[model samples]
Target: MTELVATTPGLLPLPDWAKGELSDLKGHQKSDLIDGTEGEAVTEAYDRVRAEELDWQTEAGLDRVVGGQARWDDNIAHPLSMADAVDTRGIVRYYDNNNFYREPVVVGELTATGDVAAELDATAEALDDGAGDLQAVLPGPYSLADLATDEQYGDEAAFLDAVADFLVDEVEQFPDVATLFLLEPSLVENPPEAGIDERAGAAIDRVATATEADVVCHTYWGAVPEKPYAHLMDADLDAVGFDFVSDHEANLYNITEYGTTDDIALGLVDGQNTRVEGVETVRERVEWVGEQIPAQSFDTTYLTANTELFYLPVNRAREKLAVLARAAAGEEEVTA
Candidate 1:
């Protein structure tokens, strides 16, 4: 029988305590500081927040654990924005949402900066081996390219390939993780241009092969158009995730018509909303997907948020995680 796992796609909301701590630390800073004592204090805050986030996942009975991305202020493009080869331009609206992130623009030859690996390593050390089946998250190559402007590499395909290679180098430095979730929202938010899908899939596949961990290419905000969906299926990913909570009728149709990998993720929880869903409601969503593509067909199924949980209040995000765990465990009697 297939196993049901409850996990998040990463970028969870920060707890109130962490926010206060960060505020206090910022008060002590001089000149936009992130070095010396100021930097150390921020790192300490992040470590504490990550440890608590892991505890939240474990206490909620989630099978897979993520570090909650407590240090990410720029959302999915954080690592690339930190790279020396890249420079960020004016803030842009993140997809169709109110949230915004600095759009990364390539200025020089793209290269790995090891920033992501350092953060992951720090998180792992903070978790102290307590994060069971730990996972790491990264911005998918196609989305990274889509979200970024290419000033160095003139050709679109060349720029995408460079971004993929940069990610591969970054992934190579990561501490051993069970799974890697590549958030590729642009695939759904901004559909690939004509004849770009195959190259996009190839770039993703190249990055997937860079690490030993199982890779999941998770797209959200909307469903992938049919042509891109077919090309996405060619990527060497352990599972491909789709958002089933918002505007997802097309997602169901795509899976039923074109099929998916044996291992898959269904984003049934609304990560951006404040309203919490009951376990039964989540179960019904899973059952609905099962009706379209029988549950027996997949080896492993991940129940996750439709997108990052950072948009919601901290308490609500925690409640959502608990709800996901309950649904995955088939426990209908949920409290608050």
Candidate 2:
């Protein structure tokens, strides 16, 4: 029996009211700082925002909704930057996106930053009291190394090894998490300098082996480059997510040439674009993907947006999730 699950890569926009609420909460945090309080306001705001996003995901009928990444301060690396060994720098442009994050500078020996797990647990606890399965998103080691400045570790492989080990340790802490998505956009955007793809695969293997949840290595924005694509299939992951919305052909070809038959997370919806895709259009694309792959390659399929839906307005993002849910459930297709 094939199980169809609909979920996102885990960043959803806040509703209009919550957006206003978040601004007010930020102001409150500033006032608390001036008053010399402990700054619980920010934590409170994150919890509230997370619950709201969970409600939206449930309302949209997402079978396996993520925590929605409400704790992401700027880019996906925000929580990682707050680790004990990391020195946070000023705002830096993330990729070519308008989003900005304080650069995570590795100042000492790499270790688990308790912030990521704590936030995940909080969000998971919140979702436990709600309607959807709990999920956590972790930044991939390759992407983390790419986004950071390694002030301590001189050798690139050594640094990447440290990053992967730390992530493996982090994932081990989430025993109850239903799913874990490792965002590895860097592999597609900037392939490793050289001789690093093997390390990348090892790192993924460490985490995937250590975790109890369904682990997925989700690469987006483009096709996985030939370098990393060469060895990524051997990693112990439950599913490899491909961003069909961006470059479906190359992704499918990579699967046929370099990958084995495995469960797959099909990324058919466009998260960065404003235009909402119709239910029928997305289903057609999913079918097209099936024709491109070996007939028995997938037993379980995750219907998802290509990346975070934070780029869209809250209402539009919710609509997209709803359409994905509709398609995955084999309901009548609505007019992309």
- Using lDDT as the measure, which candidate wins? 1
Q: What does candidate 2's lDDT look like per residue over 274-317, in tens digits?
A: 78888888788878877776455577788999988888998789
Models, CA RMSD each: 2.2, 2.6
Total residue pair clashes for candidate 1? 0
lDDT of each: 0.85, 0.80
> What lDDT score goes with residue 197 in model 1?
87
lDDT against true structure, model 2: 0.80
Model 1 misses residue 299 by how many Å? 0.1
| Candidate 2: pairs in clash | 277-336, 278-336
Each prediction's TM-score against the native? Answer: 0.94, 0.92
lDDT of 1 by residue, 1-336 (tens): 567899999898898888887978878775444321237777778888888888888777787888888767779888778877777779998878898988888899987988778777876776645446878999999998988889999999899899999999999999999889999999998988877888898989999999999888998988999888888889888999999987779998888888788888999899988999889999898878787776447788899998999999978888898999999999985675
> Which number leads on TM-score?
1
Query: What residue pairs clash in candidate 1, if any at all?
Result: none
